[model samples]
Target: MSVLDQKQTHKYSMKPESAPVFKNLSSDLPSGLVVFLVALPLCLGISLASGAPLLAGIIAGVVGGLVVSVLSGSQLSVSGPAAGLTVIVLNGIAKVETFQAFQLAVVLAGILQLVLGFLKAGIIGHYFPSGVIKGMLAAIGLTLILKQIPHFLGADKDFFGEMEFFQFDGRNTFSEMAYAFQHIEKGALIIGVLSLLLIMGWDNPRLKRFAFFKFVPSALIAVLVALGLNYFFKLNLPALTVGQEHLVQLPQMDTWQKLVNQLSLPDWRALQNPDVYILAVTIAIIASLETLLSVEAVDRIDPLKRVTPTNRELKAQGVGNFISGMLGGLPMTAVIVRSSANINAGGKTKASAFTHGVLLLFSVLFLSPFLNQIPLSALAAILLVVGFKLTKPSLYLNQFKLGWEQFIPFFVTVVAILFTDLLVGISIGLAIGVFFILKANYKTPYFFHTEKHKQGEVIRLQLSENVTFLNKASILLTLHHLPDNTEVIVDGSKSTFIDYDVLDAIQSFKVNAKERNIRVHLQDIPEVISTNAH
Candidate 1:
C-alpha cells in the first residue's frame, strides 16, 4: 500500500477495547452529537408518518439508545424509530381503534420478540446472501439521497423519515422532487448548500490535523451554523428567511407538568381486544426481522467487521420496545441512517448511542425551542453526505466483479427497494438469491465418470453425501439418456440418506433399461417395490 493509503487506514482503524463506557469520550461525544442531530428529526418525522403522537418517536429514540444500547451485543449499532415500521404502526393504530390500544400491542410485541430471542430465531439472519445485504445498504443510501433532496431544497411537504416510493402525500418519490423544485425556500437552500460544502470540507485530511476541527463533528456545526444563518436572514434578509414549517418542530414542553402529560401509558384494557393480539404478533415478527437485517447490514459496514450476537440484539430490542410501549413510545429497530451517521462521525462504542439518547432526553426537557430553530435543510445536507458514501460507485463495481450470481441479486434488491418498500424489496431479493442457489445445485448431486470395459464402456454415477427429492430429476435424466449397450452402476455408498422419491426413480429406470440395451446395477441403493401387485 502507498504511504497515503497506510495513513488513511491507520486513521480510521481502531482496536476494539473493553474499556469503560466513557473511555472513548472524545470520539463518542462528537459522534453522539452528530447522531443526535440526525436522529432528532427522524424520530419526530417517523412519528408524524406513523400517525402517532410526535413524542412517541422521541420516546422510541430514547429507549433505543439508552435501553437497547445497554443490552445489545453490538457496539456500534444505534437504534430508533425505523421508517420500515411506519406503515405497520399507522395501520395498527387504525385497526386497534386507539393509540393506547396500539401501545398495548407494542408491549405484547416486545414479549414476543423476547420469546423469539430465547428460541434462537435470530439464526435466520446469518443466512442472508451477502449480495442481498449489500443491496440493502446501497438501496438505503439511494433512498436517503432521493428522500433528502426535497428537504435539502427546503420543501417540507413530505415527512423527513418517509422512505417509500409511494408517499402519504399522494406523491411518489420522484414526483415529490419535481414538486420541491417549484417551491424552494431561498433561506433553507442557502443554508443547505453551505452546510453541505462545510461538511464535505471538514472530511478533508488537512482538517484532521487541527484539534478543534477534529474534535467537533461537522454535522453539529452545520446545524448550528444553519440556525444562525436563518436568524440572520430573519433580521436582515426577510425574503430569504426560512419559515417555521422548514425548521425543526420539536413539541414544546415548557414545564415539568407538560412533559408528564405527554407521557401516555399503555391501556391494559386493550388486552381484551383480539385485534391487539394480531397486531402484536405482526409487530413482533416484522420488528424482529428488521432488527436482524439492520444489525447484519451494520456489521457489514463496521470498520472492525465485528459480529453481533443476533439473539442478544433481539432480546435487547424486545426490552427496548417494552419500555417504549409502556411509556407511550413508538416501536423501534436498529435504524440504518442514524447508525450510519454515528459511524461516519467516528463513534467508537455504544456510549455514543447512549449519549445520543441522553441528549434527546435532555433536549426535549431543556432545548426544545433551541432545537426548533435548526433548519431541516442542514440535517438533509448531512444525510446526503452519508448517502453518497454508502452508495459510492466503487461499491457497484466491486459487486459486479463477483459475477452474476452476486450482481443480479444485488441489482434486483436495489431496484426492488427503490420501487417498493424495505421489507418487500428484501423479500424479493432473497427469493432471487434462493433461485440462483437452487439452480446451481440442481445438477450437482452426483459425480459421473466412465471407464472402458471388456464388453463396452461403463458409466459410474456416484451419489453425493446425501441425496434428496431435489436431486431426483438429475438422477433420472442421467439414467434415461445412458448410451445403448453400455453398462452403468448407480452408487449410493457415500449417501447417508437418500429420499424415497429418488429411490423410486432409480427402480423405474432399471425396469426400462433392458429395452434400451443398457445394463444397470445399483450399489448400496435401497430398492423401491411397486405398490400395485398383479
Candidate 2:
C-alpha cells in the first residue's frame, strides 16, 4: 500500500494491532540495542546529576519503553528519563530533603500531567510558531556543545551544569574550559581523544560497508576498546578509567533492600508544603513541554511522516510518569536521543520502543556486571557525538538563512542556555519571540490606498482582515495623504472583527472630516453601529 493509504488506515483503525511483517526487524533490534547502550549511561549520569538513585533512571527508562509505548500515539518515539529534567529533579530533591519525598512530588506531578492531558493542553504545542520551535532546538543544540565539553575533557566536577557566555564552572562554559586547562588530567585527556577518534571512525563509509562491523554499534566498539586498554595496558589514566567514584555504583544490596523495603507512602504531613506543590507543577509543565517538543521533532525526522495524536501522547506520558514515580523512578518524557536512534535504526512501529524497555529491564536484572565494564568515557564520547549533531554548523547556516527574526531568537536561546539553565534560557527566548511577533504584526499595513486623489474624487481605502488598534497608525497615515475635499469610502466588508480602538479611531476621523473638506462613507459595518452614528 501507498504511504498515504497506510496512514489513513492506521488513523481510522480502532483497535491496536501488530506491525507488519517484512519490516526490517534486524535494523530495529540493533538500533534498540544501540539506543539501550547509549541510554544506560545517560540514565545513570542524569540520575546522578539529579541527586536521585541511579536505579531510578533505569526504572524510568524501562517504564517509558514498556508502558508508554503501548499507551502513546507516537509510533517511533522513545520515552525515558531525560537529562533535560536534571536541574528540576535536583532542585526538587533539595527541597524535599529525602528522595522518597521527592518521588512523592513526582507522583503528584504525574497526576498534574494527567489533568493537563484531560484539559487537552497538548494543543498548546501546536501554537508555537515554527520560528520559535526551530530557535528552541538550535538553543538546545548550543547548550549540548557547552555542557558536554567538560565531560569530553574528563572534567567531571561540573556534571552538565549550565555554563554562561561570561562564566565557566560557576561562571560560564568558557571559564570551565580555562579551569580544565589549569587542571587537565593527562590520562583522561588521552582516552577522551582516542575515544573521539574511534567514534568518528564509525561513520566512515569504508567501515560501514564492512559486514562484520555493520552489526556492532560504534559506541559498543568504543567502550569495549576502552575497557580492553584500561585492563590490559595498565594505563594509569586518571579519568580514562571509569572509576568507582565516576561510575554508577548501586548502593550495597543490604542497604538497597532496606531502602526498597522501607518505601513509604507520600507523607500526608508534608502535603501542605507549598514547595511540594510548586515542584509538582513545575515537573508537569516542563515534562509536557519537553514531550510535545520531542514529538514534533521526531515526527519531522520520521521516514513515514507519521503524525502522533498530541492529546493521546500527553495521556500516555502522564500514565507512564505516574507509574514510574510510584515505583521510585525519576520523571519520564519522550526524549529525543533514543527517539532519533529509533528513527535511524528504522523502527516501523511502537513495538521497537516497547522491546527496548523489555531489554532494559532484563539487562538491569542480568547484566549489571557487564554494564559496569562499559567505560564512562566511551558513553561520554557517544554523548559528544549526540551533542555535536544537535549544534551542527549546518544548523547555524540554516537559521541564518531564515533571517534575523529566527536567527535572533535561536542565537539568544543558545547564548542564554549556555549562561543560564535550559528552562530560564527558553523562557527568555520565548518572551523575545513574542515581542518580535507583536512587532511584526504592528508593522503590517493597516490601510491600502493610492498615493494621490483629485479633489472630490471618490477614493476607497481597503482594510485588511481583523482590523485592530495596531492598524491605527497606518490608517491615519493613509487618511492624511488624501487631497482636500476628497470623498472617502472606508471598506471593511472582508474584516471579521474590528477592535474598539479602531472604531474609535474611525469616529475621531469622521469628526475631523469636515475640517479637511472630506466626505466620508462607511461600507459593510453593522447596521446597529452605522445607523446610530451621525
Candidate 3:
C-alpha cells in the first residue's frame, strides 16, 4: 500500500501478571532493606530541609510505603517525600501562618488529586513524546551523579535528595561541589570512599555464589561496615572518626507517648482561610505532576516493562497525601531515587515497597540509635552507583546513533536539567521534541509526483488522508511554484479531511493558473470561493 493508503495499526501486548507480594520474599526482602536504608536519611533530610519537624518526613515515608503501595497498581514504583516540593512546602508554611495550616492544605491537595483521577486527567502523561521521556531519564541520572559527589566526599553542606541546580545554601550544584572538595572531612571521606568501593565490588558474580552475598544487599553491608569502621576510628584513629554531624539523624522519639506528642494535627479551621485553599491548589497541581513524571520514568526503567494504570496511580497518591496530612506528614510523590533503588536491588513485587515501609516504622520505634550510627557517606555511595547506572556511557552512545532527531533533545535535556531543575528541563525538552514533530509533519502530509506526457509534462499532487493547518504552508508553496505550460492534477480522493485554508489555497491557485498557461484539474477536491476574490 502507498504511504497515504496505509491504515494505522496498534499492537496490543498483554500486561504480565504480578507475582504475589510474599511469593518473591527472597529477593523482595533484601531489596526492601536496601530501599529502607536509602530512604531513612532522605526522609530525615528532606523534612529538615523543608523547615518541618523530622517526624513529618518519616510519616510521609510510612504512608507512601504502606498505604500507597497497597492501593497502587504499580508493583515497582516507590513513593515518598520529594525534594522538588521542599521550597513550596517551606514557603507554604510561612504563608499559612502555621505548620498546622499547611497540613490542612496537604489534606485538601489529596482531595483534588482524587478528583483529577476520576476525571481521567492522567491521560495527559501519554502525550509526552518518547524522546522527551528518555531525555528526562538521562537528565535525572546525570543530576544524581553531580549532586551526590559532595556527600561522597564527606561534605554534608547540602541536604540529601536536593535535585535543583541552585541550592538553598546560596551555592549552585557546581559551587557546592567545589566547596565540599575544599573542606573534605578526612573521617567522612574515608567512610564515603571505602563505602562506595565496597558496594561497587559487592556485585561480582564470584561473590554472588556465596549465600552471604546472595541474601544480603550490598547497601546494607556497606552501611554496617562503615559503622564498624567509624567506631574503630573513634577508638584508634580519633582524627578519622565519622562525626555525629555526618550520620543519619532521626528525631529521638524513644517512647510511644513521645512519638504521639510529636505528631501534629492539621487545623480544620484553616479550611476557611483563603491562603490555605490557595496553597492546597498549588500542592495538588505540583504533587500530581511530580508523581506523574516519576511514574512515567519508572515504567521506562522497569525490566518487565509493565505499564501502570496512570489514573489508578493518581488515586493512590491522593489517598497517601490525605492520610499523611491527617497524621502531620510532608507531601509525597513516587520518588525516582527510591523507586530506582528498589528496582536495582532486585525487588520483584509491591511487597518490597511495603517491606521498606515496615522497616521505616520499625526503625523509628526500636532501631533509631543503630540507624543513626549509619554514615551518610554510605548512602551517598549507594546513590552514586544508582546514578552511574542511569547515565551510563553506553546510553549516550546509543542516543547519538539514533540520529539528531533523538539525540538533540536527549542532549539538550541532560544539559538543561543539570543547569536548571527537573520540571523546567522537561518542558524545554518537550518544546524541542514538538518542533521536530511539526517539521516532520510539514514534509510528509502529501505525495508529489511528476510525469512526462506526449503533449506536455504533468504534475500530480496527492493529499494524505488527513491535512491540518500545519500543512497549509507546504501546500501553498507547491501551488505557487508550479511550472508554466504544464498540466497539473490536484487529487484528494483518499483525503478524509482537509483544512479550510488548504482548500482556499487550492481554489485560489486554480483561478490564477490560466495566467501562466497552466491547466489545473481537480479530482474529488472541494471547490470554494477563492480568498483572493474578495
Candidate 4:
C-alpha cells in the first residue's frame, strides 16, 4: 500500500469512540452553534409549511435535540421538524379539523413507532439499495438548492423550508425562481452573495490554513455578518437596505407569564375518532422510514465510523414525538440538513446535538428579538453551500459509472423526487430495482446439459439446490422443446428443496412422454399424486 493510504487508514482506526460524550467540549460547542443556526429557521419554516403554530416546530426541535438525543443510540444524528413530513402534517391537520386534534395523531404515531421498534422493523432500512440511497441524498441536495434560490435572491413571497416541487402558493419549483428574479431585493441580494462567498471560502483548504478561521463556525459567522450588514445598510446605505419581510420572523415572547400561556394541550378526544388512528399509522411509517434513512446517511459521514442501532433510534424518536405532541409540537424526525451541518462543524458526540437543542430553547426564550434580526438570505446562502456539496458533479458521475442497472434506478429516483413527494419518489426507485432483480433470476433456475450416449442422445436436467415456483415456467418451456424419442434423466439429488408445482409439472410430462415414445427417467425428484379425485 502507498504511504499516504496507510497513514489515513491508521488515523481512522485510532479514533477514540469510547470516550465520554462531553470529552470534546471544544468541538461540540462550535458544532452545536452551527446546528442551532441552521435549525432555527428550518423549525419555523416547516411549521409555516405544515399549517401548524410556529411554536410547535420549535417544541419539536427542543424535544428532538434534548429528548431524542438522550434516548437515541446514534452519536452524531440530530433530529427536528423535517421537510419530508410537511405535506402529511398539513393533510392530517385538515382531516382532524383542528391543530389540537392532529397532536393526538402525533402521540398515537409515537406509540406505533415504539411498537415497531420492539418488533424489530428497523431492518427494513438496511435493505434499501445503495443506488437509491445515494439518489435520495442527491435529490434532497438539489431540492434544497432549487428551493433556497428565492430566499437567496431576496424574494420573500414564498416562505423558507419549501423543499417539494409544488409550493403552497400555487407555484411550482421553477415558477418560484421566476418570481424571485422579478421581485429581488437589492440589500438581501448583496448579503446573500457575500455570505455564499464567505461560506465557500471557509470550506477551502487553502483558506482554512489559518488557525484562527479553523475554530469559527462558518454558518454562524455568515448569519451574524449578514445581520450586521443589513443593520448597517439601513443606517448608511439606503439603497441597499433590506426590508423586514426578507428576514427571519421568530415569535416575540417578551415575558415569562406570556410563555406559559403559549403552551398548548393536545385534544385527547380526537383519539376516539377513527380517522386519527389512520393518520397515526401514516405518520409512524413515514417518520420511521425517514429516521432510518437519516441514520444510514449520517453513519456514512461519521469520522469515527460508529454504527447506530436502528431499533434504538426508532424508540428514541417515538419518545421525543410523544413528548412534543403532548406539548403541542409538530411531528419530529432525524433531519439531514441540520445533521450535516453538525458533522461539518466537527461534532464528536450526541452532546453536541443535545446542546444544540438547549441552545434553541434558550435562544427562543431569551434571544428571540436578536434572532429575528437575522436575514433569511444569509441562512439560504448556508443551505445553498450544503446543497451544492451534496449534489456535486462527482456524485452524479460516480453513480453513472456504476452501470445502467444501478444508474437507472438512481436516475429515476432523482427525477421522481424532483416532481413528486419523498416517499413516492423512493417507492418508484424501489419498484424499478425489484424488476431488475426478478429479471436476472427468471432465466437460469436449473442446470441443463446434454451428452451423446451409445444408443441415443442422453439429456440431463439438474435442478438447482433450492429451486422454487419462480423456476416453474423455465422448466416447463425446456421440457416442451425437447425432441421426441430422446432419453432424459431429470435429476434432483443435489436439491435440498423443490416446489410442489415444479414436481407436479415434471410428473405430468412423464406421462405425456410415454405416448410420444420418448424414454423418461426420474432420479431423486419427488412424485406427486392428485388427491382431488375424491
Tens-digit lDDT track of model 2 for 1-534: 445335634782436444442365656666677677767766766777788877788789989988998888788889998877887898898998877777778888888888887787877766666655665555665655565566666665644323235332355666666676776554455656777798788767798788656666676677777667656434554344544443433332233455465344456556777888888888989999989988877777688887877777888898998888888899989987678666654467777787788878777656677666554555666666766666678988988998998888878877776667656776787888877876665555634444456677799877777876667766766677778888988887877776766666776787798898898888986566544443
lDDT of 3 at 425: 89
Off by over 4 Å in 2: 1-17, 20-22, 160-171, 206-215, 235-242, 248-265, 272-274, 341-349, 446-456, 465-485, 496-519, 526-534
lDDT score for candidate 3 against the true structure: 0.85
Candidate 1 per-residue lDDT over residues 1-534, each given as its tens digit: 435334433433334344545688999999999999999999999999999999999999999989999888777899998999999999999999999999999999999999888887878888999999999999999999999999999985778878999999899999999999998988889999999999999888999999999899999888888989999998999999888888889998878788889999899998899999999999999999999999999999999887777877888899999999999999999988888888899988888999999999889989998999999999999999989988999999999999999999999999999999999999999999998877765655444443444446877888887777777877776666667888888887787777777777887888888898888888876544223210
Which candidate achieves the best TM-score against the true structure? Answer: 1
Q: Write the per-residue lDDT of candidate 4 for residues 1-534, one digit (tens) a residue.
A: 435334433433324434666578778888888888889988998998899998999999999999998788788999999989999999999999999999989999999999987787877877888888788888888888998989999985676877788888899998889999999988899999999998888878886777667778788878889989998998999888877877788887777677667878889878689999999999999999989988887887789886677777888899988999899999999988788788878898888899999988888778999999898899999888878877888989998999988998888888898888677888998898877666655555434444444445778887778877777777887777788778889887888787777777887888888876678787886543222211
Residue 472 of model 3: what lDDT?
80
Cα lDDT tens digits for candidate 3, 1-534 = 222112111111123334456578998999999999989988998999999988999999999999999888777899999988999999999999899999999999999999988887877777787777787877887888888888877885678878999998899999998999898888888888888888878978899899889889999889989999999998999998777878888877778888888888899999889999999999999888888888888888999886667777788999999999999999999998899999989898888999999999888888988888887888899998888888889988999999999999888888888899888888899889888877776665444443444446877888888877778877777777777888989888878787877787777788888999889988877544223322
Model 3 misplaced stretches (Cα beyond 4 Å): 1-19, 446-458, 466-470, 484-492, 495-534
Candidate that beats the other on lDDT, 3 or 4, i.e. the better one: 3
Instruction: Report lDDT (CA) for all predictions.
Output: 0.87, 0.71, 0.85, 0.83
Residue 416: error of model 3 in Å? 0.9
- How do all models score by TM-score? 0.90, 0.83, 0.89, 0.87
What's model 3's TM-score? 0.89
Index of the highest-lDDT prediction: 1
- Roughly what TM-score does model 2 have, to 2 decimal places? 0.83
